[model samples]
Target: MSAARDWLFADIGGTHVRLCRWGRENGAGDIVRMRADASAGVADALLGFERAQTQPAAHAALAIALPVRRGPLRMTNRDWILDPESLRATLRLRTLCVVNDFVAAAAGVPVLGERDSLVLREGVPGPGSRLLIGPGTGLGVAALIGTTGGDERVLASEAGHMGLAWQGAEIDALHGLGRTRWGRLSWERLLSGEGLGWLHAWRSGAATPAPAPEVASRAAQGERAAREATQWFSRLLGAFAGDLCLAFGADAGVWLTGGVLDGLAETFDAAAFLEAFDDKGRYAATQREVPVRRVLAGDLAFRGLARIVDGACRAPMLRLSAATTHRHRN
Candidate 1:
């Protein structure tokens, strides 16, 4: 494997870090998963992976679970902070690209096959924008806009931090509780792994919250409060997703992915979710007609990074200005 030809790709999330090597001849290799907290920081983790590899890669791309800006990057859910320039120097890479994790995930949308997703709702597929949203340690949102020339543009968003809307008394009460606990309420407050646990605790009137996995397990075992919490979670997710669809005019479709939903696959009520999704008043019929699907593929971010490395997708490369400030292409 020549250093100039081989590429390294990493998907760094709140809880886990997945890294893989890609080459022109062989494509992407097996992914190596590690706890995000196992290393001191992002640079340390990448360096550790490189040290273990037989030969270092000359080019790299990283899909990180944070807003990719001009300078250093800081994660919303984890304590890790990454400086791309320092990373490039430490790894001795000829080129480096870093993008929002959802941007990478959305890039994989055009390549999804029949086995990659499951239809939650059937509707007409038009030439409009496609919305990709997922819930994990935090919620993520991105849009894939198709151009007239056939090329696509990926738009990364921090829409998860938007204020959550509530209609019913039950939801209003939950919103109040969330505000009291967290001082403010965003969609991510009740849609993420930690949020699920908090929802279960609030619903059950428990002093302490259970972990997300335990809440799902209890729901699967027929626990009333746990089941209700899980159901509410699904419904809320649908409502928020619907709002985003309308906001982005994502008539093309909606693709759902994330660890929390994957874990709830066995017990998730698609009908309930769809019902809430289509409850958009006068636009209910239109909302019902928009296709919705749940992504079943694992390591989607890696698949996307592979596209960037293969030149199938164009992600903004990290560059340093003469003033030593970082800059990125739009």
Candidate 2:
């Protein structure tokens, strides 16, 4: 009999779940994107995908947006929770590996295509660490540690929860608003979709908030408030990314991902973003030397999962490693 060659990979985010099948030829099939809302059962989605396979998959890897230190993980930006043990039983897999979604994105860096990203800065990548940060439902961060052997190991982080830091009175006022409402503010609070809504409301004085996509659409139609909110959003995001780059010593490069940035790619003020990214007082020189790019590949976490299941990357410690380093402290 032919060897059982099916492997499964999933990138579970707050808004959507992307699932793909890796075949014996080492190629992935079309990504199956599903909305991740109250009605979507994780098990049901997996089973539905599994029914198309000739034989059950031998292994599965899931890159989830939430921190993965142990079992029963609740998403930071959504109302869904997952139990690894239950998923293993329900999916009937020989091995199941769950990793932070950013970890997987870091792993896929080695394979990111030339057309897969836009270079925001042109600094050559040093033989050091690379940073990956994405602002989706919440912010995601991770680093790819480069070794002398040319291999890379992904280190997951909860850097999104790090305090929101910026320079300028306008940003300070926004910070004040965040602090007043939440008592504590992280980078995620102001750099995500919900963050964009809050910014729009703060700028436009709208009694009712609007979704982020609508704000972007309005901005395109020459709405001043939406335009300014989007501009500040990009600018603040740049400054936050610069802080992360320095903190991690990611001299190689920094990659931006997530649906928020992705949607604003064409309209986002790239020059303004670069200005904030390079405005780190004394460290400005080094910051300017570090490259920045936006990942354009869809389902990047899913691709990273494929790399892990195919033995192209380090094998994760599954649930144990997640629990040990799962704390989201700076």
Among all candidates shown, the one with the greatest TM-score: 1
Model 1 worst lDDT window (10 residues):
319-328
**How accurate locally, in lDDT, is each candidate?**
0.84, 0.78
Q: TM-scores across all candidates?
A: 0.94, 0.91
Residue-level error in angstroms, candidate 2, position 133: 1.2
Q: What are the per-model C-alpha RMSD values against the true structure?
A: 2.2, 3.5
Report the C-alpha lDDT of model 2 over 1-330, residue by residue, as the tens digit: 124447678888888888887755757777888787633666767888788877787667788877775658787877778777788777777667788888888888778889999998889677668899888888899988865235657788899998887756776666777778888878898889888888888789886568989988888888999888888888988898888788888899999999888776576888888889889999998888888899998967866776665666662436322223233211
Clash count list over all predictions:
0, 2
Error of 1 at 84 (Å): 0.7
The TM-score obtained by model 1 is 0.94
Q: Using alpha carbons, what is the TM-score of model 2?
A: 0.91
